[model samples]
Target: MTDVAPARPGPAPRVVLVPGFWLGAWAWDDVAPHLAAAGLDPVALTLPGLEPDHPDRGSVTLEDQVCAIEDALTGGADGVATVLVAHSGAAAAATVALDRHVDEVAHVVWVDTAPASDGFVMNPDVEGPEYPLAVQWDEEMAQGSMRGLTDEQLAAFRQRAVPQPAASLRDRVALTSPRRLDVPSTIVCTAFPAAEYRSYAEQGVPFLAGLLEYRALELVDLPTGHWPMWSEPERLAAVIADRVPRGAR
Candidate 1:
């Protein structure tokens, strides 16, 4: 008789999730269900400015976004262990918040998102080929894309995709890496190449702290569109589950 091998164990660990640019906390709505089943609790929230109907959306800045997440982490009396997940532009904001509040964060997941970047500094050419929704003025309230939106979704985006603060993206980013964050980080870009307006090609290694930070990064590539949360939530959740271990609290 042949000897049988032992079975592999499942992963564990809860995470705090953040969304990319032009996306509110709603971005992860589809993915949360899968995470819930896998025994990973996802702590999700919208950044301060991306609300559907905020009166003052343009005034939102990087500091403001970071503050909102920091408040959520520190607000509760019982501290929870969270692996921070950031998509797209939110990566910059998350970078700042995590550096300041690492005591509360366990790991960081970058999903087709920019790495820890400088949100405060920018080149003088500044105004790029792209603008918020292709519109220069913040008051217009448009930037970033909604990958799997329907007609109704597009309308909703048109209504809610508020103008990002000019300073947030234009300003130089301020993020520092503490040694404690060395082991828990993963960068998940989609399996396919980025489309004209859908890819995160703008993000490069320069964005990460190759020198100062001591984290080992795992890159998980999956076959899906830009919006994996909507197009392939189950698979995305599986990929995420692989990176985070359970009972990390």
Candidate 2:
């Protein structure tokens, strides 16, 4: 009698893509296909309040966002590695998720933003029932950020952009787990150079300071704008595909 062999599992790791403020899963539409081509599974999330016609923006807090990402990580198939990729304002929620699920998450990729420290609020002063998207492109760009976006792309972004929940920005991130600092992390520098970001971390900049705690920190330069998914989707996907592992860690 011939012995039957068990079927081997597919890929070990999957990439979880979390878009920043005013963006939904649609933001990753361009990037996901490329990741798939590179043999990676990309799960792009819209987040809670950012969804079109979502009930109440004010009710969505940072913890709610964190929980959403956490559910994604834990709900995946057993023994599958997971990489959390967060863009812009979503970094805080990603950080909290990494803190809570340190054992399960393999890597954290921060695009144009860094993890926020405990008690940190992204924009506490920007009072919001919901923060409206800025209409002016020039005024919307932050210093070196938001480069490489065309006029048409800008117009499209403005038209589709949703208002960010106030609580998500104003509520503090509460992280008690110190083990989160042990996870490997990569910071994709889009608006700023890697050297400049490292300098900021060295200087004890509040937001960037938490990066110093990471056991394995990699600074990758994407050299685009704040929204690389819109500006350079292929390049963004390539960078992410290269950094994330294919097998369980």
Candidate 3:
């Protein structure tokens, strides 16, 4: 008798996509559907605290974002060990949430974002003491008081980039120690810099190398600006599908 491979059990691992600040879950519009085609359940999630409609948009904080994500990944959700895909600013909150609830997150992809570096690591990257240019930098961020898209991209971005609570950026990520978590992570780094803001902006991947677990997940480099989802959705989705949990795809 010929030996055959045994079938895998249980539900397919899910890919939960989180957009950067100023972006709604809709940012993952093109990617999630592609994940679905590849046999992974991809869904873009908007943390509860992110409400564009509210006048007091500043009410939200990083902790609140993490808590909301915690509930979204709450036990008895769709699948086990779900992959958390976060872009830009969301990487900070996603890192905290994963550390807080390790079991819930199987892997996290920091796509064009920071790795939530510990104390000293975060200090140097500070925006400095100027509004828009430096201080009040959080508000200057796209999620904050920054400008939005053109006439064509306006509608879509408006629907997606909702009001992220101000507290999220104000509150820092809590770190017990300067140690890297064992949780698998993938950094889908972009080839082109979104804005020539700072030196490290050009070397984002290299900067995060000190924090991310390069050995754990595949590090993909896409030739595009910061928002690959908007510029090159198909390619971005392909990268995500590959890094998603093995059984997931």
Candidate 4:
């Protein structure tokens, strides 16, 4: 006589990759295959106005971005959790979405960004529908690190970058549930160190303030530029895969 275990149900946890301002799902091309190779399903999303030459760019709001993520979480098979990987500015919308659909998400990975709390507006400085990529790039260079990118990579980034929707930046983040804090989360520190991230959270930095109250949070230091997918795809993929539960992987 032999005893066998019953088969597990549903699909493995899906990895949903959301890019930040001025970018599209194409931005994740370098990282997706690596995640797939690690036995994980990776889905990169291009939010409403991020598509090149998108006709309705003028009207896309932050709420729309949140909805896009909600749709992704719901579109999957039942009982299959999702690993929502949000990068840079996309963290705002991802924060709200995670709060709304906590049970549907297995884990959240904030790469080079932090979870914004309720009423957090991305950028109030911009007054129009589109924030030019070049202008944004200049600001990023002045205020942030671009350490790991090569000249060719920078060229490709400039060539493909699209205008970010100012409305998305202007609309405030709306959070209703506190349960999201209980969802397992990881902060992948690339442009900065984990210690700095902790300090920022402790100091009540608006974008990272809620982290202080998270029930299951882990900080990991990758030590690269902000856009690790472009600079260190394989390494970033490995870090993300390591977060997934072993059964799902």
The top-ranked prediction according to TM-score is: 4
Steric collisions counted per model: 18, 0, 10, 0
For candidate 2, the 10 contiguous residues with the lowest summed lDDT are: 1-10
Worst 10 residues of 4 by lDDT: 1-10
- In model 1, the Cα lDDT at residue 81 comes to 52
Of candidates 4 and 2, the better by lDDT: 4
Best by lDDT: 4
Give model 1's clash tally. 18
Model 1, span 8-116: residue lDDT tens? 3343345667876667777788788777766667767788767767676556667888888787656543444566777766777777777787677666777875455
Cα displacement (Å) at residue 110, model 2: 0.5
Worst 10 residues of 3 by lDDT: 128-137
For each of the candidates, the C-alpha root-mean-square deviation to the true structure, in angstroms, is 7.4, 5.4, 7.4, 4.7
Rank ordering of all candidates by TM-score, starting from the highest: 4, 2, 1, 3
Runs in model 1 lying further than 4 Å from the true structure: 1-14, 75-79, 118-131, 134-160, 180-183, 191-214
Residue 129's lDDT within candidate 4 is 78
Clashing pairs in 4: none
Model 3, span 1-249: residue lDDT tens:
112123246655677888876667777776777666666667677765554565555555567777767766664355555777888778777777776776777777778765675431323343322112122334334442233324465456654555455556556667553233666776676743333322453465533533444346445666565677776677777776666555443
lDDT of 2 by residue, 1-249 (tens): 112133236754689999998999999998998777666678999888898899898888888889899999888887777889999889889888888899888788899988878877777897758987877755547445678887787777888899998888888888999888878888999998999998998998877867777778889998988899989998888778766654342
lDDT of 2 at 37: 69
Instruction: In angstroms, give how far residue 163 of model 4 lies from its true place.
Output: 0.5
